[model samples]
Target: MYSRSIMAVSSWNDNGQKQFVHDPYELYRSDFFPGLGWMLARSTWDELSPKWPKAYWDDWLRLKENHKGRQFIRPEVCRTYNFGELGSSLGQFFRQYLEPIKLNDVQVDWKSKDLSYLQEDKYAQHFANIVAKAKPVSGVNVLQETNNIDGDVRIKYRDQSDFEYIAGQFGIFQEWKDGVPRTAYKGVVVFRYPSTRARRVFLVGPESLKLLRITDS
Candidate 1:
């Protein structure tokens, strides 16, 4: 069993109550909170290492800098600050609003799991396994909003889903073209090896494209 703790603002009432969200920098969205019963239940309590908070803080700070109009915690949020100051402010905010949660005994996986696989052979084998067992991808679409008669307007597809993903599987359709899903392919050939293009940093779950190496050649 894995043990984890989340901070709640209030104590348990006569009504059944439980863990609360522990985000300090996040803007409260009333509309989003009411329907999170499914998501809250399924969240895995990872043995998320200590470095995660530092990594997250750096990313969060950078993201906040990109969008200055949305800072609700700091009054002089426009002013730039160091990591120490930001962290201090976060601690203060946490003390004000949150109470430490009590929980039943949980088994802790203290062994450090190294996620950074730097070896080339490991990566190659990983991709190979994914491609070997991947679901067949179908229904790719390419839409040209502006027509150019002079030359072929170069179009690129981002690594995203066209339709709702089912069981960690997605598709690049053949017949689903001209901005619509269709029944069958129109003279399309899929690939055996995964494309090196459209790369993204993967620190978590397996990428959808890695499994389905089927790209237009």
Candidate 2:
């Protein structure tokens, strides 16, 4: 549910509420923030892994122990990154990596920036320095996008036994890879669970859907 490991900055709203945004493309896509020029550097097992594992958590605990007094969440908006606390380097990142787009408000999880693509290059160490100073809490946000809305497309897991087709529910198509079948792409999920044949499910379809990924009480 989470995205790949990437360096990020904390951005804030006028009301003092804060959120972490790490995607350079998304930063440029919105109008409220600036962009920076930085490339992600990857050289770790967690970075390569599809999901964070126990080993990753173990390392994160060690990092937390090393910086016991350090505060990951800023008391106030960062001066250089305050628009809304969107950073000064936002423009640089936008120009370098994204198309002409405004850095807008977006969602991000900042719990794993300890060793993101921090090393930009050999000449400039400012970004690297900033990244080094930023110590995210030890954790991982499993969900990429949590917004749920009617008519929004999402991914859901289904089973082989049930073949019910509900209107308004966009059925996801999967193809076999290496003789194994799989979903074509990934996106947000309207249904809490998943289905084999995805359909554009309506909020009020005639039939009630029992999500597959539910926990039993």
Candidate 3:
């Protein structure tokens, strides 16, 4: 049978207002009480463990051996710290179980408000180095085609006689804008060649070539 001690009593008065009456022993058991039960348990452990003679070690070992699953009171509740003994005990328990896990190994890609990654010179330099290392194979023939209806420029190149470029490969385009030449980046090809034209296109605004700055590549 489980015994429940009435730690507190709340009553509704004639006007329907509630009032609370607390028992001293129950208050000691409560988180609001100071220097009792759980609070006493944790504090006593801390104090006695230091001053306790070496002779107590045998009894401590025996207690651990006997009461493996038993729950003990904590000092937080008995001390009336507002948070209560259970919170403190829970914190200790979680720490004991979780401390061995390595938090650094967890990979979290968080979207941050800070744009510091854009300003970092090392990241920029690393990207620049990667771009510098990439070398397109030379001596390969490239065919240029223009589409007036869609206002796009297309480039067709061959790996073999009948094959088109890979679906995801990017194409860089140089075109004229306002009588000056400008370079623009384009999206990857969506379809491979032989089914459709293996051509990659850039749909820059019309009249872009009026500003073309023609220079030898």
Candidate 4:
């Protein structure tokens, strides 16, 4: 089962992951699985049916499944969005985030694609390789240095506020949930760089790379 790509919603050409430019429809592993739309197998549903939580089912389901050593796949460009602004959170970040989320208009041929690489172990290994190869950039004005880099670059953020500020500089999604930025994998958020460039930008947390468990080879 997979999430229908809720967070980090944007057009295929606008805010998609730069690394997957040739296959923008490619799915990646996610920390939170579902919110707007998702799929569930009947067998899996039966296993979780009796133990459903009464509140925050989405969050609970994600944690529940995740605790079972399960991995969920989500699209870089979200397929669904949360428009109910009058909910419990009371329109918080509605304008700053939700309102700016662009619905994908392009049709993807999902049936024709080979998505086997999205399996838990394969995706984790592939994503880890990408993160390992990213050039770490550091400076008082780190964003400026990215302009001189030839390939993907990684910038570290100290905390939530720092992440928001960095995200603003790059104009990517700024929201975070459970210590993860939008579209993050192991606490690293990735997107195309400079708006005019196709190079990738990796916004990483202090210990994010370690979580990938990369080893010397």
Residue 67 error, candidate 4, Å? 3.9
lDDT by residue (95-177, candidate 2, tens digit) is 43222222445433546434333322221243223222322211122122222322223223342222122211222212122
lDDT of each: 0.22, 0.24, 0.23, 0.63
Candidate 3 TM-score versus the reference: 0.18
lDDT of 3 by residue, 1-217 (tens): 1112211111111000011111111111111111111222344356446645565342342232322322221110011222333554367533432222111222223243332322323323432332233222222332222322222233323322112232123221122222211111111111112213322232222221222221112
* lDDT (Cα, 0-100) at 151 in candidate 3: 25
Q: Write the per-residue lDDT of candidate 4 for residues 1-217, one digit (tens) a residue.
A: 2433222222222234232233346566665443566666555677777887888876665453333545455666656665767876446465555555545567999888887676554777888888788888987777798889988888888888988988877666676655556566677777766535556778888778778885422
The candidate maximizing lDDT is 4
Greater-TM-score candidate between 1 and 2: 1
- TM values, all candidates: 0.20, 0.16, 0.18, 0.71
- Clash-forming residue pairs, model 1: 1-107, 138-173, 139-173, 139-174, 140-172, 140-173, 140-174
**Residue 184 Cα positional deviation in candidate 3, in Å, after optimal superposition:** 5.0
Q: All candidates: CA RMSD in angstroms?
A: 20.2, 19.0, 32.5, 5.3
Top candidate on TM-score is 4
Provide the clashing-pair count of each candidate structure: 7, 40, 15, 0
For model 3, the stretches where C-alpha displacement exceeds 4 angstroms are: 1-115, 140-217
